[model samples]
Each structure stands twice: as C-alpha cells, then as structure tokens.
Target: MNKCIFFFLSLYLLCFQSFAQTSSVKTVPNADLVYEKTKLGEQVNSPYYEGQPVVSADGKFLFVYRVGHPDNVGYKTYKKDEDIWVGERMADGSFSTMRNVGAPLNTATNNAVLGISGDGNTLFLYDQYNLSADYAVTNIAVSERTTDGWGKPQSIKIKGFRWVSEPAYMNMSVDKRILLISYANNRVTFGKQDLYVSFLEADGTFSEPLNLGKDINTAGIEASPFLAADNVTLYFSTDGRAGYGNLDVFVTKRLDDTWQKWSEPLNLGAKVNTPFWDCEFSMTAKGDVAYFTSGGQNYGENADVYQVKIKEVARPEPVAMIYGKVLNKNTNEPIATKISYTNIKTHQNAGLASSNPKDGTYKIYLPKDKAYSFFAEKDGFFAIKENIDLTGLKTYTEIERNIYLVPIETGVAIELSHLYFMQSQPTLLPSSEDELEQLFDILQKYPTMQIEIAGHTDGVGNKQKNQMLSVQRANAVKDYLVKKGITAERIKTVGYGGSRPIASNEKEETRKLNRRVEFKVLSK
Candidate 1:
C-alpha cells in the first residue's frame, strides 16, 4: 500500500510540472530591449468589447470590430452581432470619436472588417451569411471607395466551392494579388479553423482556396491571420500549440517563393503575449509599431486595442516609411492631392497614396534596395517632385517631409527633377518617363495654358557645344509630349545653355542643379 501511494504521488507531480512549463510565458531572447506598451484609451476604446484592429497605410485611420454598442448599426442585441467602426487619428496623435462604418455593410447581422488595401481604397469584410440568408454560409466581401463614399459590397465566391463557413479573418498582399484567409468548415481544413490562401487569377476570379498545411495549422483553432507589407512575414493566433493562454499570437516567415514551406513558428514572448487572450496583431507600414487586442486590468472585462513600440528582435523585414502633410506654400492650408511613387531601378511602381482632403496628410511604404521618384500633384498647383534613395540601406527608417505645392502663375517656373539623359547625348533615359508623364498631365488639365520647355547645362564643356546640346534636349521633350497627343503648338522650346544659373556651379551637387530641364508658363 505504501509503494502504491508513493508512485501515484510521483505521477501527479510530473504532470503538474509539464503543465506549468507549457502554460508559462517564455522570456524574450534579448535582455536589453526598449519598448513601451500603452492602452489606446477611451476615445478609441469603449466599455464594450473591441478587437480585430487594422491600421491604414497612412496611419491616419483605424478600423476595428466593436461589439455590444447600442449605437452600432448592426446591433441586434448586446454581443450577438459585431459591427465595424472607424476612428480617425487627430493631428495631436490621439483618436477622434469612433463612428459606425454603416449602410450595406452593417445590416442587423455580424459584419467585421478584416483588412484594408495599401492605398486605403478597398475594404475587406466578412459577412456571417450570404444575402439569401442561407444557414452555415459565409462570404468575404469587398467595398471600393468611390468619389462620393463606399460603394455597395460585393461578395467574392470561389469557383466550385459552396458554403464557405465562418470566414473569421482575411488579409491581402501589398499588390492585392494574394489573399490570406482564416475560415472554418472547408474540405481541406486541418482543424476546427485553419488558414488558407487564394490568388487573384488573370480572369478576374479568385482561384480555389489552398490550406496552409501542418506547419502553420493544427487540429486546433487558428484565426486572425495578418500578412505584413513585406509579404514574407505572417502573424496569426492559435491555440493548438503550447502557449501561455487559450490563444496566443505566433509569427512565421515564408521560406521561399513556393509559400508552402515556412520557418517554425515562434511565440511573440511575454512582452507582447500574456496569460489572457492576446491576438489580432498588426503593424504599421514600417513595422516599428504594433496594435493588438489584449484583455487586462486596463480593459475592464473585455478586449481593447493596445499599442506597443516594436522591438528590433521582433520586427518584420526592413522598410522605409514616408509620412507627412501636403500643404499650400502660400497660405499653409492643407491641400488634397494624389501622391505617386515609383522605383527608379526596377521601373516598377512602389505604391500610391492620397492626401486626406480634410487634413492633407499622407503616408506610404517603400522597400529597401531601390531608388524612388515621388511626385505630388493637384489642380491649380505646380506638382512637387522629389527623389528618395534607399539603395544599400540595412535598417528601417522613417522620413517626415511636409510637401508644399506652389500655385501655378505665369511667372512661376518648375524644374523637372526626374528627367534624365545619357552622359553627353540628348536621348531621354527610360527613368525620365514618370516625370514626363506628369508634365503631360498638367498640360491636359489646363488645355488653354502654354509653356516653354527650357534646358540648361553647367559650365563644364565648350560653350557652343553645350548650347547646341541644350537645344536638342529641349526639343526632345517637346517632341515626346507632342507624340503623346498633346498639341505641338502649345509647347515652345528654348536653350538657356549656361546663361541662367539657379545655383553656384563650383561643386558637383550644385552643377547637377544647374544642368536641368524646366517649364515656365507663357500664357493661361
């Protein structure tokens, strides 16, 4: 009898030890980490439950799921239906009052925002059922931003699949070509819930969904998947793996282009994950800051959105973030304009954004190892052109530049900073296309306006040869614009040669400024 009791006690102790090890949060790898975690406060978070937060690329707007709010458009009863809410970030960095996203999106049922496109023009939402009110049916819908407001939501149906049950969350790549989804009751789902991916096919239909396999999914709940802008790192919440709580956030990296292989999942550690539910993880474009839902003392009885400075050890791939306001140079008033950026090396578009019509703020993300040409343009104002060089940069960076657009006038002249030419020849480089297109757009907008294309050279070569080359360059621009359907009579060409110097021609930087192409309005 004594031996039997001792053996049972030993067994009990071993089981307890295993449970303790598995349920305790792991310490972060680094010892000296600098980070500050703060709750978003009452302006954005209410007494009701809130989760599933997604920030816009510009960081000016936040979309989230709010539950049990009486004012919610879809509120049938307290916590039965969830609705999407939007909160605008103020100039002081605090959030304004939360507002319901409204209309066809919220129809007295459960509708939640899953993700938003990088341009802030498309919104992804998951509806609990199709329009016909079919049982156990789910649909992933998208609403595009029109000139007036959000248009009607359209459901995305998979080819040959039926009854897509409970689409819990979804995310898309920066280009919107690949979609990452977390749904339940599919044929290939490994568990009660799993993560899947679909590609946007050339036919404008989404391909069949493919499960994300055993490496990322298990026979347990896996939901709230978020793919970072870098397109390689993925974050999701799971309960099948060893974690401190019933659900915890985990991150994995795509091993290759195949997307089938991935690195082993790693827990985000105690700093970000806690003993309670900590999920719905998302990061800013630069991945420097993260927002998530946490249930703690700060949040009375439900989950609330919280933010923390992302430490170096847990960040995604390095990227450079450009964010600021676009204002009128004369009156300092905010101006609504379209912002476009392109990679100069690869000749691919980096991304695009629009300044907020009310505040004129904008933000965009640029990947490393390429030079970029950024342009800001609006009607009745001269376009602003600037260059950003990120080649060989090894770390993440944030640039805050306030762009000032000059109003167009007869005497105002604007330099075409992105126009490039071969060493000594008048042939236009392919890199000059983006800038030339901007000039073409300006002419198209103001049809009655006429301008002179002027080319200048630095005082380095022979005077007569320089003057002749300048003339060739000016005529080259005029010919290109004319070929693009612009009236040749509207554009006149001139060669200033070295006569007009905007800056001293002593140093290489100054000389480069002198060797330029510009346009001055001749008439309006």
Candidate 2:
C-alpha cells in the first residue's frame, strides 16, 4: 500500500510540473477540437467564392475579395470576378451585407484586399495599380484614406521586386514595423510559395524579400502569413507541413529578433483545417476571435470568409489598442494628421498611424510591458503630447485618448500633458523633462512669445498644502525655462489649487485630471 501511494504521488508531481511548463508557452488547438466553424451569415456570402479576408484592428470592419459575382466591378465570368469588397461586423459576431468598396480600389484588372493597417486608414491591395498584360499578381499597392474617399492605389516599392503566385497574400503588423508576405515563382525560394518578411526601412520602403528559411518553407508551398497584434506569434497556411489535406493552417511563435528563428510550427488542428485549401488567417486586437478563408474540397466552391472563437492557449500575447481622434482645440473639428508613438524610455519612435483625413480618427497598437509616448502634429498648431505606461498590462485593453491641438497664439492655454513628479513635492520627474525641453524649443522658435505656467492639484490633500504645492510646481517649470535661456521676466506663474478643477474631485479617477500643469500664451 505504501509503495503504491508513493508511486502515485510521484506521478502526480511530474504531471503537475509538465502542465505548468506547457501552460506558459502558447499551445495550438488539437485535431480533436470540434471547431465551431464560423459563418458570415447570408448577408455576405453567395454561391460564388470569397477569400483573402483582412479584419481591421478594431474588428469592426472586414475587407475581402470575391470571384464570379455579377456585382463585381469587372465581373465577366466566375473566373474574372476579381474585385474587392467591404463589410461591417454585425452585433451577433457575423457580418452585415457586403458591398463593392468601389472605384479606385476596383478596376478593370483583377485584385484582392491583402491587408489593412492597424489604423484602418490604409489598405494593402493585390497587384500594382498598373497590372501586367496577363493580370498576374506581381506586387503590392497601397491606398490611403482621403477627405473625399480612398485615393488611388499606389504600388509600394519593394526593392528587387517581381511577380508572385496567385492568391499572393500578405499582412502588416499592428505597429506597421514589419510586413509579412508569401510568394513563389521568383528569385529566392526554399520551395513553391515560400513565406518571406520585409522590414520597414527608414525611408518608408520595404527591403527585399528575406526567406523565412527551411524550417518554415518546404518544397510543397506556404502562403497567407498573418502576424498577430503581439508581433511575435504568427499564423499561416502551407502544404509543406504535415496536416490533414492539400493546404492547412499552422501557428508558430517567433524565437528572436532575427525573423528567421521560430518555434516549431503546429497544425491548428482538424477543426480550423480542412482537407481543402485554407488560408488568410487574421484576428482582432483581442485575438479571442479569428477570421480566415477556406475552400471546400470542390474547386472554389463553398469558398467563403470564416470566423471562429480562438482557444485561449492558441491566442497571442495581450496588447493595448490605443485609439481616438485629433481635433482642433478651438473649433472642436477633426483634423487630418499623423500620429506617432514612441518608447518613452529610449525616446525613439516605435511606429506611426495616419488619422483619417476626413474624420481625424486614429488607432494604434502598443505591446505590453513598456512605457509609451504619443502625439499628433499639425503645421499651424501646437502638438498635444501624452505618455502612457503599459508595463502592468497583462491582458488586452482598449484605451481611448483624444488630442486637442491648440493653435499657437495669444490667449491659448494647453496643459503640459505629461508632467510627472514625486508625491507631495515640486521636483519634476526625469520622465517629465523631455516635455519641458519641448516647451523650450517652442520658445526658441517664437522668440517674442510670453507665457504663463499654471499649476493645479487634486482636492484630496490639505487645502493649504495643495495651494503651496501648486505654486511651487509652477515656479519649478518657470525655473527650467529661465535656465534654458528664456528671460525670467517673459514668463509668469500661477497656482490654482483644488479650487478650480476641470473635473469633479469626488472620485479618484476624475481627481487625477485636476492635477496638471498648463501653459497659456500671454503674448505671441
């Protein structure tokens, strides 16, 4: 009896240890999963084919390509109906009726909607604006949102580029830092339709295709690579790996900064994979639900967009989707602009998003475990800046922050936006100095402008102390400007303790808003 008990005890310990280890690493769904197959409802699908789906980062819109649809802008026959379509996600987790995204995107030549930037303001489409005689998928083109509508599709200059195999699929990372592509019938190859990656160059062009190597590329084929919001986990379709059928979807985690190193690919299992051709996998920023395309065993028959709930173990690392709009502070109207996110720690730009030229709305993905600073810039207005620390975020989060750029003129006052300091003291935190330097630069630009630094505090502390603290904070800001070579007399300081509040101080959440430093232009 004692020996049996000891054996069981030892076995239990081993099993527990193994479970803990495997749980830390993302696991692929097994073949046995009764995958709750996804559907787009009757509103979006027809008797024809629809593939190559790109879900917006917010998961509210979906872009895809269809074949043999009479409504296609260039529809001649089932083989010739290669036009892009757009649809909105319904409340029930399916799509509403899809319609032709229309001109500029749809032309006489055939193409597909390959990718959409995280901001939902740019579309990476199939084939260049000018297609070859045969309409072969050659390169990628981009179309950006304009005040009128989507502008003309412009081809991206991938150094040393050429043609690619049909259904040539691609995807962009959340930060737009890297672009993943799958192609064949070209210069370098491990096999047919091998996967490749192109790093975004400093000049806004993509580097030459860098093959993912033999571990990922096999002699068979690989295509439709989608990098998740985390930018480390990847989902792709290939016939090279061992799977149920001709083309199956697989998931792998990147092992290092060098794009070549990756974990062993795992089949997403029988549920998501069919013996038929399956490709174009994507997910929302949350990564809990997924969207892809699968062709039934029949040729292009039953080809439609798919959506399914993702297993927890298969989900990528969590990320924060920060979004909102840039508006004119005085008029309260949206403005077209470029929003840039930076790593506050290193003070290096991490990525950029262009707000819709018409609406001024924008969105960006910030990976967990770091501090970030972002701003929106317009020529005639002073840029509003903000800093966010995401180090403690362990799950997917959505943060909405708006920027109101004040016009640089007399009577205009804007909060410093990112001042930090120790509790109960006026000493500016190291993190806050960069913003002060920005102020100095503005002063240098407009040599004759005079400004007033105003300090504020929450209503929680002692009233007298709060007043004193606010005054000291204002003086601290003035001293920094004075030491930076600005004349001391050109600046004025004031403190509005708990008395004047932008928000009610009844709650801690709103109270924090009251504790801020703002500068008003005394003269310009």
Candidate 3:
C-alpha cells in the first residue's frame, strides 16, 4: 500500500510539471516566436568566422565581418585582422559571391563594418590599429557612397566623450539624427558595457552622449546595439540580464520621445536564443525577418550568420519612406543634387539626403504626422519644391517622388512652399525661415543673381484689400532676405492679389494653392 501511494504521487507530480511547461510555452508573445531558422549558405558563411550581419534597408545587400581568410590584408600578423565583406541578394533568394569591401575601408589592420545608413549611401566602419608596439587605438570612420564606389573615409570624433569608456558598436536612427553607441568601461555604466545615445544638434555637432539608464542596461555587459528603421525599437545583446546562455540578443523599445526611457528588455526566447553565444542582431525595415550571429550546433563550431522569421519584433516609429532619382529636366539624365526637408509646422529641419551621382537615385526617411516642405537644389539648377502632408498615416508608407531640377535661367520661377502667414494677415510666420534661408543661400551662391519675390492672395476678400495684403507679404519676404545681409537692391517685391490665381477658387485646397509666394530668377 505504501509503494502504490508513492508511485501515484510521482505520476501526479510529472503530469503537473508537463502541464506547466506547456502553459509557459503558450504564453510567449507571438512576436517573440520564430517560424523558421535558416543558415546562410557558403556564398555568405564559410568555415571562417562570419558575424555582425547588417542588411540594407531595401533588403538587397548584406554586409558581414569576416575573419581568417587567406586573402586578408593582415595575413602575416599573429592576430588576423577582420574585414567587412558584402554580398548581393540573388534572384532565387541566395546571396551572390561575397566580396571584400576592399581598401580605404580595410587595411592591414583590424577593420569592422559598424553600420550602414537607412538610405544605403553611407558606411560606418570601426578601425583599430597598433599605433606602436606599446599602444593601440580604435576609432570610428565614415565612408560615403560615391559614383565611383565609396569615397575616402573620414574619422568621426565625438565631442566630450568620457575618456575612460571604449566604444564597442554603433547604429544610427533611420532619419540619421540620433546615434546609439555601446561603450564599455565607463564609470557611469550600469554594467560592463552600456548603451548611450547622442543627437545630431541643429548646428551639426553631436550632443554629449547620455546613458540609456537602468531599464535597458543591466549589471552585466550589454553590447551590439541596433536601432531599427522605425527609430524606436532597439535590439541589443546582454549577458547581464537573465537569459538562456552567453550574450543572448534582447529587444526593448523607446517609451517616449526622450531617449533615456525604455520598456523592459524582452528575451528573444528559445527559438532565437541558445546556450551558446548569440549576438549582433539586425532586421529589415519591415521587421519580418531577423539576422543574428550564433555559435550553436546547427551553425557549426564557429560563429555564423543565421536568419529567422520572427513572429513578432518591435517596430520603428511610423514613417514615410521617399525614394527616387533626381534627373536633369531636359536631358533626362541623372544629376547629383542636395535634398532638404523642413517640418512646415515647427519650422525645424526634417533631414537631408543627396541623390547618388552614379544612378541619380536617392532615399530619405521622414517621420509621419507632419506636413513637410521638400526642396531639391543644385549649383546651376533652379531649386524645386514639393509639399507632403502625412498627418493621418496609420502605417509605414513609401512614396516615389522623382525630382527634375531645371537649369537656372531667366524667367524660371520656383514657388516657395514653406512660406506661411497668420490667417488673412500679412505677417510672415516663423515657419517661413527655412524657405527664406534657402532663398538666402541661392542669392549668396550667385552674388549677382536678381530675383523678384511675388505674393498672391486667395479670392476671398475685396480686390483692393487683397492687393494690399499681397504686397505686404511680398515685402515681408524681401525684408527677411535683406536682414540676412543680402543687398536690398537685388530683391524686388510685387503683389498679384487675386488676379493671378494658379488654381481654381472653388475648393479651399485649390484656393490655398492659389495663395502663394514665388521667386522668379530675373538675372544671374
């Protein structure tokens, strides 16, 4: 009777344990689940250690850090140098033959690819070399994608970096405004390594780095931070937090506009984490697939890049992606041009990107829910302006806007899209500064260029009153330019009133278009 009782108790305990395990498995968030794991084939992974995979925003290119190659520039050294290799996605979904990113970026010393910009026009590299037998140094450098491959690299120096901490890895926001860096050995660190962020100030300098705080950083090391294209989700690796094994990848999200606050870190779960080291995770802009480095048995003894279909992953802020080419209006040939965008309501610089001279193609990321004024400018071309309003966006969107810049010649009129004023009043709004500055730049670029600033009012008031208001608005623009140091003689102001309407006055939208400001190049 005693033996039977003991056996029955053991059976009950086993059943209970099984049920608990099943329930726990069911409780995992769908986003934390992965549908499949695929080991990238020889085109990407070799016997050599390949890690730190980053895919292009368009998902057409893959960049990875590779070690132990016979063709390595550091082959003679006792410690082989690591370099970046890139592969193009093939038609069948496999990658093409991997090619070394090559020199200027890779030298006889250790060099690693840190991150690529969302537009795929910039490459960030970590360069470390022995300055002398007694000491070594590591620094981050940037290489711009030019018509003829990557241009020469330039070292990036952050002002006011604490001397004690060493930077591990870095990633930038989709808009290229905020930079996230992992630093080790700083006195303010919450763990062996912690994530810090720096913002691109209006003056074009990086702000002092600030810690991400205790919610994200742990008492153990946290490294390999990757900020998603949405700009809010961050994926990083930590051995400090409770996890399945060494340096498992985890994700957290920015809770608010402040970079310091974050949601609690969530482990990627058993499907993604393993007993061995798993780190250096990155995902596509859409967040459907995740690429990470692992040393699990399935990937062999050495670290290799593996990808999985993540059931759920944190998404970036809702954004509208703009991509297209800038071409010569007449020749239809691609032209390299500078693109600038301004937030119409806040009068803030949204961001800037340049079209690739080689292909004339360019891409930019814009935060949604704001009206924007986009301008494309080049030295000899009359600048063009485009207005976009994304105030009601509910999901990510892509816009194709190919710009054609006309050569600066007499009679070329470029409308000022950003100029605004108080309702029915002649006073210019502060948001007009961006367009005013742009006009200032054009005038400065062509010292002798003469332009006529014209203002028109919608057909909503008395003709005489409308004419007076239009003239005042035009003079207001002229005053701004003169205040900025342009000679008053170079600018002439005029008012068309409601006589010269560009669109019909039947609808408010058309009337808004009719009420406009424009500059016509008179002489250059």
Candidate 4:
C-alpha cells in the first residue's frame, strides 16, 4: 500500500485544510512506472532547432517553437525569427505531422505557445501583437479559439513586467488564477532567469510578478515552468539544481499557499533526463503521460519533443473532470454562456470555462477532496450555483452534470441550488455563500428587482415546529441580504412546512431535496 500521508485528515474542509494544517506531503516517484522516451521524429524535430515544447490542458494539441527551420515564417536557413508549429494527438498515441502556425501568430519575430487554458478555449502566446517588422520586446499575449480559427491576440498588462534579451517561459494555471513564469525580472530576480508567479486580478489583468523565492529560484537559470492541474505540483527545468545534465527537468511540490516555500526538487532521473539538456515537461489532467523536450535525443545537439508514460506517484496530484452542457430549463434548448466555479468554504474564484456556442458543451478539471459551486450565467437567467463534493474522491473521474438555467421574471420560483443550513437550526452554513452571493449580485445588477424567500422542509418533520423552523430559516436569509444594504421592503418571506415536497420524503437522500430554500421574483 502507498503510505499516503494526508496530514490534516483531522481538519475539516470548512477550515481549508490544505493550508490550515501541516505544510508537508510525500509523493514519491515510482521508478518502475516510468517508461522509455520516444522522439517525435521528422515531423517535429529538424536539423535547424526544435525546443520549447508545450502541450494543451486536454492533451489534444501539442505546440513547439522552432528556430532557423525552413518551415519558419521567413524560412531562414541561418539564425532567424522563431515560428510555432502544432500537432494533434492521434488515437494510436502518435502525433500528426507538425504544421506551421502561420499569420498573426508567426511573424518575422519569435513566437511560441506558452500555455493553453484547461477548456482549450484560450491560448497563451509568446509576445504582444503590436510590434515593428523588426524584433520587438517579448511579453505574454492571449488569443481566444473562435469558429474562425483564433481571435486577434491581445497583450495583457502585467504590473512591473519588462523583458529585454533573456529568454522567458510561462504556463497559465488550469483554473486561470495563477501564471507561473520563468524570466529575468531584475527587480526581484535572485540571479539570472528565476521562476516567479503572477496572480490573476479582478479586472482580468495580472498582478505584479513575485519571485517564487530562494527555495525554487537561484543565481542560475530556470526555464519552462509548467503548473499542473492541482496548482500545487510544479514542474520546471533548471541548471540551479543538481541533475543529470546542464539543464534537467525537475518536479517540486509547493508546501503552502505561499508561492515561496517548496519541497526539495527531485530530478526526473536518467530515464527522462540525460547528460545533455532535458526540459519542458507537460501533461494533461490524467497526468499518466508526459510530453517534454530532450536535446540531442535524435539529432546531434538538436532538440526534439518526446513523450513518455509516467506512473501515478510521479504525476501531478490527481484531479476529476466535470463536463456537460448548459441548457434552458423551460425550453430544454442548448445555451451558449460562460460557466464559473468557486470554492464554497474559502469563497475564492476556483475556475472558469465556456460552453460551446454551437453545442452548449463545457469541460473543466478540478482537484479532488474539495467542494465547489458551479453554474452558467446570462442576462435574463438566474445564475444558481450547483454543488459538487469531491472530498471523498479517490481516482480520476469524468462527471457529467448538465446545468439548466431558469428565466428570471415575475413569479418564477427558482430553488436555491446549493443553499444549506445547520442541522435543525436556522443558521446558514458556509456552503451557502456562493448561491447567496450570486443572488445578491443579481439583485444589485437589477436595482428595482424584488424577490420573495421561501423555505420548505420534508414531510417527516413536526407540522408546527417545522413551519416555525422554516420561517426562521427564510428570515435568516432575508436578514443576511438586508444587512448587506438591500431594502427590507423589497423582500418578503414564507415557509411551507412539509407541504411542497419535491421528492420522496421516506429516504434521507431524496428527502433533503424537499428541504430547500427558493426565491421568486416579486417584481422586476
């Protein structure tokens, strides 16, 4: 048995156990589980140069940047501007022939794909779009995947971010909350290129870059940082750590919420590392297979992208996949919208995804052992948050949950999806924060809107006491909104004790559905 040391099982998720307890964990790499590496061959690797490998979150797309290759934008036989190439993963585990990603992405200047969003709807590009025909300063840019190829790349603003000559690499977190970058920011950089982190701000811009500190960065160079789906496990290449090569790939676990502390860096061993240069490790949600670049693997002193199967212990922390469609409740039709999720206990922005415009489907990967509140939003739709508990999850899973958004209008009684109360009391539980905050937001957006709060209980409860308890719970919610500055006159409350059971009351599973809080628009 794997001697898993989950330090804070005694702590509750409500307390945010990951950071609330010990700042230590053990995820030993199983040497037997690592397979031999295979080069990508002529399609990706060429005589000129091939390096800086990046794989999409879904593992469907693999992109690499090349230098001096004839297939480049300028087709330079000598040293020239870089160009990005893309390949799709075939069913048989082979990648298709690399095709030059032309136009806006590949110019007379260097270009690369640093990261891709979890939903595969967004791409994190190498540099800004507005530039002279000559090479310009490099900075990260973003582009959305549209029906018409990709949308125009937009350069994002990062406070105090500047670059001149040194190379840089970055990876956007799976939830898009954090950006892990390897760059030489002279201000905080301990030495040459050091690993740093930037947080996603409320306005969609990135905060000022903060060096990941001495534990992970050194006076040497750190390149190609890849933040795994778990957000805690980080894989990067560095000459700072003792390894098999000049620059070897290493895995490190983040000790706490602070981007500073880290576990001792572990080299990937000779199986994945060599006496030359080995780096750029990327994987999908499953974390079973890895795609990286190994220099001089096929051609002498030339870099090539390679793939290998890694065992569970060496992979990133396991995560579960949630996928489904956002549909209309009344008409049962597909709806194209943005889906958002939040951590109920911590009340933090967890992740984001987009439903396909044509099919209304969305996919998101989340870490196990936590609770989440997720939903889709539209102007006329009430963005009710549905809950999911992965606290007991033990393996990778694909959970399909179709969200149905109900129209917001007069007399539309929409039950609060994830709202809950303390056992038999009227106190609102912490998990109710997401739904209530959403309700508050909708009310604020539409200033003149009025709503009624109704509470219900299962039929097994005492009639009079149940009615009193239900009313108290409804009042509790009303008080919450009122304290938040909403006018009391615009809100009303009622309780239906065991009268409107939505499901069978005999079993606790279905009976819980009957005990719920709902809201109806009194006026709009």
Clashes of each: 0, 0, 3, 0
RMSD of each: 5.9, 9.9, 5.3, 11.2
Task: Tell me the lDDT of model 1 at 51.
Answer: 75
Candidate 2, 139-252: lDDT as tens digits: 678888888879998877677666634556678776777788887746789887888898878887889879888768889878889998888888898777667666788888
Checking candidate 1 for backbone clashes, the offending pairs are none
- Compared with the true structure, all predictions reach lDDT values of 0.76, 0.80, 0.77, 0.79
Candidate 3: list runs displaced more than 4 Å. 1-28, 31-35, 129-138, 162-167, 201-205, 296-301, 311-314, 329-332, 380-382, 404-406, 421-425, 444-449, 457-469, 483-487, 498-514
Q: Evaluated with lDDT, which candidate comes out highest?
A: 2
In model 1, how many backbone clashes occur?
A: 0
- Per residue, candidate 1 scores C-alpha lDDT tens digits across 164-283 of 344366776554557787778556878988888877765656677788888899999888788887778898888777776657778898887677788888777666666677778777
Candidate of highest TM-score: 4
Give the TM-score of each candidate.
0.73, 0.77, 0.84, 0.87
Cα deviation at 59, candidate 1, in Å, is: 6.9
Off by over 4 Å in 4: 1-35, 46-48, 68-79, 132-138, 296-301
